[model samples]
Each structure stands twice: as C-alpha cells, then as structure tokens.
Target chain A: MTAKISIRGVTKDFSVRDHDEPFTALHDIHLDVRTGEFLTLVGPSGCGKSTLLDLLAGLTAPTHGEILLDGVPIEGPGLDRGIVFQQYALFPWRTALANVEFGLEAKDTKKRERRERARHFLDLVGLSGFAERYPHELSGGMRQRVAIARSLAFDPDVLLMDEPFAALDAQTRETLQEELLRIWEKTQKTVVFITHGIDEAVYLGQRVAVMTSRPGRIKHVLDVEFEAREGDLRADARFGDYRHVVWTLLRDEVAAARQEAPVG
Target chain B: MHLLKGLRRVAAITLLAVVWEVLPRTGVVDRTFLPPLSEVLTALANLAATGELLDHTQASLGRSLAGFGLAIALAIPLGLLIGWYRPLADFLNPLLELFRNTATLALLPVFVLLLGLGETSKIAIILYAAAWPILLNTIAGVRGVDPLLIKSARSLGLPAHRLFQKVILPASVPTIFTGIRLAGAYSMLVLVAAEMVGAKAGLGYLINYAQFNFRVHDMYAGIITISVLGLLFNVLLASLERRFSTWRATS
Candidate 1:
C-alpha cells in the first residue's frame, strides 16, 4: 500500500521571546502513514505529538522539511484532512445538523442537500433524534460524536485526532473508541491519532510511534499485530509483551518530560 | 400560574397607588407640596388625551433606539477585530480608554456646536455615551473565548471566516448581549440628558418644560413615564437574554 501521508526530515522551532533563544518542538521527524491505516503517535506530555499532528493537518507549516499528502505539498488547511479535538468544539449556536453542515458549506451544495446530508451523518453517529439540539444541550460524548460526524460528513481522506477522548470518562472513552473503530472500518479512511494513553494506542493503531521528550524525536515504531475486534486481546500473551516493551521505552522519556519546565 | 404571578404584581402596584391616593387626601402630608395620586393620574390622562404624551414618548424612543442601534453597529465589529488581533488591540486600547473617560455629557456643548442644537446633536450625545459599554463588553467577550476551542477549530481546518462565525461568535454571544443591555440603559439615560439641554419635545423636554412652568403634576407624570419606559426596555432585554441562554440552562 502506498503512503497516504509522508513526513520527511520535518523540524519545527519556536522563538521564545524577542531576545530569548529559539526552542525546537520537533526534531528531524520522519514518518509515513500507509493508506487506510490507523496510526497513533504516543508520547509523554510536551513530546510534540500534538504538534506533529498539527503539522500533518497543515494547520501549521514545518520550519524544515516537507509534508506531502499523496505526494502533493500541503499548502494550507484543506478538507482532505479532518481533525477532532479533545474538547468538543461544536458551535454553541448551531444544532447538531447545522454543525455537521458547516463543513460542507464550502462546497457548492444546495441548502436542502446540505441539510439532508447532515441529517444522514447525524443518524450515522447515533444522533438521529437530536439534529435540532444545540451543542450546549448535549453531553460531552454526544458533542464529540457530533464533531466526528461533522468531520466525516466532508468525506476527508485522513482523520487527525488529538487526544479526542482524553477529556471523556473511561466508559465514554471506551465506547467512543469502539464507535470510532466501527466508523473507521466502514469508511476505510486513513487515521492519524495522537494520544498519551498506551492502551488506547495499542488498541486502535496498526502502528504505534513512540516519541522522546523535549526537542521531541521518534524513539520507536512498533507494528501492532493484535486482533482488530476488541475481545480477549488484552489478555493475549503478546499484548503484555508489547505493553512491557512500550513502557520500558517510554519510562525515561516520561521522567525527563516531567522534569522539564514547559515553555510556550 | 404565570398569569397569576403577573396579576399579583399588578395588584401590588395598584395597592401602592391606592395608598398614595389616600395619603394626600387624608392630610397625612401637605397637599400643596404633594398632589394626590389621583391628580397625577388625571394629569397623565389629560396629556394622553391631548396626544402630547404619545408624541413625547415617540421622540424619546426614537432618539434612544437610533443611538443604541448606531452604537451596536460600530462596537461589535471593531471590538471583534481588536479582540481577535492582539497588535490592533494594543494600538487601539489606549485611544479607546481616553474616549471612554472623556465624560460623554461633557461633549454635549461640542456636539451641539458641530451638529447644531437639533435632533442630530441630541442623538449623537446618546450614541457617544452608549458606545463604550458595547465596545468594552465585546472586547472582553472575544478575548474570553476558550483557547482550546480556537485550537480545535483550527485543527478542524476551519477557514478564518468560518472560525469566527462558528466558534468566536457563539462563545461571545452572552457577553455581547450583556454589552448591548448596558448600552441600551446608557442610551436612555443620555437621551434624557440630551433632550434636557435644549429640545422642544420628548419626555425629557416635557419634564423640563413642566418644572419651569411649575406644573409639578405634569413634571411628576413625565418622571414616572421615563421610569416606566426604562423598566420596559430592561424587561425586553432580559427576555431576550433568557431566550438566547435557554439552551445553556437545559444542559
């Protein structure tokens, strides 16, 4: 399979102050995301996993190196790459249907068509009866589901998620993870997920890319060979081995990240 | 139940009016200094019958609404721009502060000199007084939008316009509405003061004319009318706020 997203020698830097020294957020990052694959970037806080996702989504340009989507240089944010955030960012004034329709507004779709399409996606996300309810009226998980439906409504090639379940309760997160998997399987869209949760990474990703702290760089890339369906996999002997290996690789990096004072 | 509650309020007001009507007639106070409540009501009826009350009310309402609308139109977009762009805010903040501090009523003479002592000058004074609250509240509202929400919108590949429309506008609605309500109150207050400066009509003019003519009953009538108008405007805005915030309340 061809790589859907290719990041080669990507480096990102931030200037702290007018007179202060510049800091590197990502250092010489190189990664490839295969088409229709679920890839997770996992690391300690400040390891620049979210930064890497931002770059991949073309929300920010890389200071050095290029990110190509299907071998085309990313000029700016486009509908081809959809993003879901940790906090549900649904528009408070808009109902679920309107929120989903927002992504399609740039298209030349008619108002009736947009509403119909939005309704379809809302139904897909189990919000069929709540198209008229505003974001403020929904629960946290419901809001996130609306966000996901909104992104998917655009039919984007890749979905970039930044700790999309971090703010949710354990039960809600697990339910969402299963829902995400079902959606991903049905859509067959490539996914680049960033998270700090090891189990989440292991459970969802075809490959888990672990990173080291400040001036973040990739430490290891492990291919997950677990069953796609969520049953007895946690109890699998190989699952424990994979977990142990990832934990050992991340141990020192977590400590270093904890010790380092964060700078904007 | 709501109708019953409203009836109770009307009953209480009527009781107070009855007490006022009885106190002066029963010699509890000097009748020369204080007219009975019935006399004030009689004066109100006379003014209404002659169409003077309606005319004055319409003039006052026109000035207040015009100034209030102009202030909202000017403040919302300017405030949003300043709030969204830090450099612009830094440059404009000091100037805005100076303008806000320059005692709007003090500008009455200058406004009259520039626009002439007509309706324009009066309305301009009201606008000047009303603009600051809306502008400041808008700035506060825009700045107060959660950064996380902004980040989320950016990540979702929202274009600049959509980002503002979707996230910034909705998040800032409560604050913007608060600014608008404050501006509404200011407009009413300043319009009265403006009319008092030199006007031939409006409730303010009527009050001033009554005081000069020593028609104390009409003066009190004008004062009561102004108070009622202010209360009515406040109630309308409060209902609007409730309508907008209903979704927030349910969740």
Candidate 2:
C-alpha cells in the first residue's frame, strides 16, 4: 500500500526547566499509515500519543528523524493537514457555518464558495439546521461536530484527530465515533485518530497501533477485521476478542505510566 | 414579563421622585433648600425653552466624546500591541502602573496650570481618565484569548498577521468592549469634575452657577439632566457591546 503518512524513526524531546537532562517524549517511533486508512493510535495518558499527533500535524518539529507526507518531508503546519482537538475549540464569536469557513477563508476561497462549502460540511456532520448557532448556543456534542466540520471544510489530505470525542458523555461519544466512521468512508481521507478508549480504538480503526509509556514507542499494531460494522457488531464475539487483544497489550503500559507519574 | 421587568427597574426611582415631591410640600424638608420634583422639572422646561439646556448638553457631550474617541483610537491599538508582544509589555508595564494609579481629578491643578482653564484642559483630563481602562482592558482581552483557539488557527496555516487579526482580535473584543464601557463611565465622571473647575458652558458649570445664586430648582434640574444623559449613554454603549459580541450568552 502506498504510504499516506510515513513516520520514520521520529523522536521528540522537551527541555525541563530545572533538570539538566532533556526529557524524551517519543523515541524511535516508526509507522506507515496507508492511504485512505482509518488508523487509531491507543496508549495510556503521558504515553506521548498527543505529542505524536502534534508532530504529524506539524505543530511542533520532531527533535530527531522526520515525518513524511506522500513523498515529501513534513516541514510545518499546512492546509494539507487538518487537526481536531479534544476540546471543541470552536471560535465562540463565529456561527457554526462561519467557524467551518475559517480554514477556507485562510485558503482565500471566494465568499460565496466559502459559505456553500461551510454549509455542506456542516450538513455532512449532521448539523445542517444549526449553521447559524454560535458555539455557546450548541450542546457539547454539536460543538464537537462543528469542530470536525471546520477541520474537514478545507479539503485536507489527512485528518488528524486528538481524542476529539473524549470529553463527551458516553452516549455522545459512541454516536460521534459512528458518525466519524461514516464521514471517513465518504471523504476517503487518511485519518489518524488518537484515543485511550479500547473499544473506541477497536470500533473505529482498521489498524490499531498500541504504544508504550515514557519515551513512547509503538508496541504493537493489530489489524481489526470485522464482517459487518453496523448495529450488533459491538455485541459480537469477534468484537470481544479484538477488545481483549488491545486491552492485554495496553494493561502493562498503563501500569508503567501510573508508576512513572503517581497521582498525589 | 418584559413589562414587569421594566416596571421593577423604575420602581425605586419612582418612589424617590414621589418622596422628593412630597417631602418639601409637607414641610418635612426645607422647601428653599430642597425644592419639589415638579419645581425642578419646571425649571428644566424653562431652561429648554430658552435653549440653555441644549447648549449645556452639547458642550458636555462634545468634550466627553472628543476625549473618549481619542482614547479608544489610541489605547486599543496600543493595548493590542502591548498585550501580544511580551517584551513591549514588560518594558512599559511599570510606567503604565504608575500613571494608572494616579487619580485624574488629583491632577486638576496641574492640568489647569499646563493647558490653561479652557476646553483643552477639560478634554485632556477626560482623555487621561478614559484611556487607562480601555488600554488595560484591551491588553487583558488580547492576553486572555484562549490558547486553543490560536493553536487551531495555526494548524490551518494562518500567517501571524491573519492569526492576530482573525483569531486574537475577535476573541479579545468582548473584553476590550468591557474596557470601553468602563472608560465611558470614567469619561463622564471626569468630564463633570473637570467642567466644575473651569468650563463656562457644561451641565457641571450650570449646576455650580445655579448653586452659587441660590437657584436650588435650577441646580436640581442640572443634576437630573446629567443623570439622564449618563443613563442614555450607558444604554447606547451596552447595545453597541451586544452588537459586537453577539455570541456571548446574554446575562
């Protein structure tokens, strides 16, 4: 498969304020995301999952090695990649449609085209009737939908999401996960979704990458294969098997993460 | 519901007006010193008829508007720059703190001496008083914009100028307007005090002149006019703020 995003021995480090030694966030991380693939990255908190996503989004440069998009080395944030954060991060001053149009505006899209494309993306996210509503006016679930729409409106080649549904209630989270899958199917954009939820990783990703804690690295990558993805799939025995596999892989890493940073 | 809220808002003022009318008439208060509300209204009407009310009102508004306008034009941009650039803020913060702490009214003698007891001194005082709130608020608004919003905008490949213009500027508006609204009230307060010291034509001068001649009704009328003008300006500013920041859940 042609690589949509190729992570090559990528490592990241942060200098500590008081300490002489620099803290390693990610170490020798290597993964190849296939074009038009739904890849979920799962790891415990402090495992540098978000830092990896930030690296892919070109928000922060890697301390060593490099990341590539198609055949080109990633330099910095560009309109070619769209990112959705866990927090809705919708501009409160802008309406739902206007918020979606933000990236398009940056691209210098014509005013009428921006409006139409914004409305279309808003509709795709099932917020067709709420184009005029501000972020504060919308419910948490709806606001996240607007955030997704905003990221997708600019027609980016890759959609990088950083636990975009984690803040939502259980019911909203599940519903959005399903909707995101549907949107990914329609858009055919290479999606790198980060989540801590085992079920979420299993349900969304065609390939799930598990990471180890403290100087994070890819521990394992398991392919999720299911006959049907509708309704009773979560109740199927195969679903339990996949969830079990992911949990067993994550359990030790989660424990190590807890020891690395004990709660006060 | 709306009508009830409107009536409730006016209830205290209505009760006070009734007390003013009855206290002097019933001899509970000295009539010469504290005239009835009707006498004050009558005096206001006489002032209107002779065009004295219009002249005084125009003069007060002109000075207040000039100083307020200049403050907004200068302070908002200065605030934005100071707020966004850390080095500039650090460089000027102590100087700002010093001047902001000094009372506008306390410098009345200095203003009179430096600018002379003319419109320049009065307007300058109003400008000095109004600028601080706007400048401080603009800085705060800029500094207080959610970092997440900036990150999101940056991920979209927005240039620095566009990021500041689109994300930072709009996000800071509600706070900046908060400053402007405060400055509006400050301008009114400083304008009255400045006018009382020197102005030949404002509502403050009119009140001072009336009090000296023992025209108590005229003095009360001037006080009432100032209150009414202040209330109207407050309403205008609130509506303007609402217009700019429509996304905020109305409190």
Candidate 3:
C-alpha cells in the first residue's frame, strides 16, 4: 500500500536561552503512514510523539530531513489535514453547527451549502440536537464530539489527533474511542493518533509506533492483529501478550529517561 | 413571587422618600439647605415640562456615546495586534504605559488649547479618559487567550486571519466587553468634568449655570439627572455584557 504521509529522517530542535545548547525533540525519525490506516504514536511524556504529529501536520519545520504528503513535500498547514486537540478547541462564541462550518467557510463554500455540510457532520457525531448550543454550554464529552465533528467536516485526507481524548474521564474516553473507530470506518481517512495510553493504542490503531523518551526516536512499530471489536479484547490472551511486549520496550526507555535527568 | 419582589422594592423606595420629605418639613434639617422630596420632584417635573432637562440629558448622552464608540474602535484592533505579534507589542508597550500613566484629566488644558473651549474639547477629554480602560482591557483579553486554542486552530489548517476570526476574537470577546463597560462609566465621569470647564449645554453646564443663578432647585435637579443618567448607562452596558457573555462562564 502507498504511504499517505512519509517522514524521512525528520529531526526537530528547540533553542533554549541565548548561547545555550539547543534541545533535540526528535532524532532521526523515519516513518510511513499507510493510506486509510489508523496509526497511533505511543510513548511516555516528552517522547516527541506530539512533535512528530506537528511535523506531519506542517505546523512546525523540522531542523533536518523532510515530511511529504502523498508525493508533495509538506510546506505549511493546508486543507488536506485536519487536527483535533486534547482541549476540544471549539470557538466559544459559535454554536456547534457554526463551529463545524468554520472549515467550509475558509474554503468559501456557499452559506446554505456550508450549513448543510456542517449539520450532516454534527448529526454523524450524535450532536444533531445540539447544533444551536455554544461550546461552553456543552459538557466535556459533548464538546469533544463537537471538536471531532468540526474536524471531520473538512473531509480531509488525513486526521491528526494529539491525545484528543486524554483530558476526558475514562468512561467518556472509551466511548469516544468507540465513536472514533465507527467514524474512521465510515470515513475511511488515514489517521495519525498520538497517545500515552497503551490500551487505547491497542484498541484503536492498526499499527502502534512506540518511541523512546528524551530526544525521542521510534523503538518499535507493532501491527495489532487482535479482534476488531471493542468487547473482551482486554481479557484476550493475545491482547495481554501485545501489551506486555510494548510495555517491556517502554520500561527501559522510561528508566533511561529518568537516569538522564539532572539532579538539583 | 416576582410581583412580591417588585412590591418590596417599591415599598423600600417609598419609605426613603417619605423620610426625606418628612425630615425637611418637620425642620429636622434647614429647608433651604435641604429641599423636601416634594420640592425636588416639582422642580424635576417643571424642568421636564419645559424640555430643558431632556436637552441637557441628550447632550451628555451624545458626547459620552461618541467618545466611547471612538475609543472601542481604536483600542480593539491595536490591542489584538499587540497581543498577537511580539515585536509590535514590545514597541507599543512602553508608549502605552506612558500614556496610561499620564493623568488623562491633566490633558484637559491641552485639549482646550487644541480644540478650543467647545464641545470638541469636552468630547476629546472624554475620549482620552475612556480610551485607557478599553485599550488596556483589550490588551489583557487578547494576551489572556489560551495558547492551546491557538495551537489547535493552526494545526487544523486555519490560516492567520481565519484563526483570529474563528478562535482569537471569540475567545477574547468577554474580556474586551468588560473593558468596554468600564470605559462606558469613565466616559460619563470624564465628560461631566470636561463640560463643567466649558460651554452652555449638558447636565454639568446646567449645574454650573444653576449655581450662578442661585436656582437651587434646578441645581438639585441637575445633580439628580446626572446620577440617573450615569446609572442608566451603567445598567445598559452591564445588561449588554450579560447578554454577550452567556457563552462564557468565567466572565
């Protein structure tokens, strides 16, 4: 299968104070995201999973190497990619429908057409009754649903989610994960989802890319071959084995990161 | 229940008015120094019938609204630009601070010199005084926007202008409206001071004119009208703030 996103040896560096050494956020990262696949980047905090997603989204320039969308070199943010954030960043003043219509408006779609498109997405996300309500009026789960609807309204080729369900409670998170899978199945768009949750990665992703901490680099990429449905997967024998293998790879990286920290 | 609450409010106001009327009539205070409530109301009615009170009230309202509107127009865009762009903010920061620190009322003489002793000078002073709260509040509002929201907008492929319209502007609105309401009150206060130093119109002019003519009843009426007008403007802006901020719980 052809890759929708190709990251070739991408490296990102951040400058500290003046004259101080630059901090490397990502080191020699090379990854391929297959078209119409759900790929999850999983690791501990500071593992540069978010940085990698940013690079893929064309929000930041890599200090080294390159990222290409389809065959074209990724330059800056464009209409082909949509992003959902952990904080559910819906426009506060806009009703749920209008917030979803924002991308269509940016593309200068006609008013009636934008409204129809936005309403369709809102209905898809189970928010049809709440189209007129503002973001602040919605509950946390409802807000995230609205965020998802807003992103999906663009009908982008790829959806980049940076821990989109991380801020939610466990029940809400699981429900959203299920909702996301249903949406992904229906939309058939490639998704690059970043998360710290190993279970979430196992449950939702076709492939899980595990990274080592500090100056983060990919340690392993495991293709999940478990039952596709949500129920009893955690109790399945194969699921435990995959979790243990990913956990073992992650344990050493977490230890190494802790050892390298400067003591006060 | 709502009717009961309304009746309670009326009863309290009537009680105060009765005390005010009875105290002066019973010689509890010098009648010349303190007019009875009846006399004050009679004077207010006479001024209203002659349309003199409405003229002064309308004049004050016009000046305050114009000054406040100009301040809002100038402050919001400048503040948003300053907040969004670091270099622009750095350049404007010290200048804005200096202007904010400078006594706005002290510039009354300068306005008088430049615009002359006319409505223009009075309105200019009101603008100068009202501009600071609005400008500073707008700056604060824009600066206070959550960075996460901006990141989300950018990552979602929103261009600069669209990001501002979709994310930054809506997020900063509540704080900006707060600034506007504060500026609304400041406009009236500054306009009154400016009017006192100048022409032949407005509540301040009427008060000064009444003092010279020794129409103590008209002076009292002017003072009461100023208070009522100030309260009405405050209520108007406060209601607007409430209406706009229904989506924003924190504000």
| Clash count (model 3, backbone only) | 0
Sorted by DockQ (best first), the order is: 2, 3, 1
**Residue lDDT tens for model 3, A90-175:** 87878899999988887788999999999999999999999999888888999999999988897899999999999999999988
Docking quality class, candidate 1: acceptable
RMSDs, each prediction?
Answer: 2.8, 2.0, 2.7
Better of 1 and 2 by lDDT: 2
Among all windows of 10 consecutive residues in model 2 chain A, the one with the lowest summed lDDT is A255-264
Which candidate should be chosen as best, given lDDT against the real structure? 2
Interface RMSD of each: 2.7, 2.4, 2.3
DockQ of each: 0.48, 0.62, 0.57
Each candidate's lDDT (Cα)?
Answer: 0.87, 0.93, 0.87
Cα lDDT of model 1 by residue, B62-88, tens digit: 999999999889989888989999999
Predicted candidate 3 versus true structure: per-residue lDDT over B1-251, tens digit per residue = 99999999999989988998999999998878678988988999999999999999999889988898888888888788888888988998899989889988888899999999988888788888888888888888888888877886787667788888878888888888999899999998888788888778889888889888888888888888888888898999999998887878741
Q: What is the TM-score of each candidate against the true structure?
A: 0.91, 0.95, 0.92
Residue A97's lDDT within candidate 1 is 93
lDDT accuracy of residue B42 in candidate 3: 95
- Minimum summed lDDT over a 10-residue window in model 3 chain B is located at B242-251
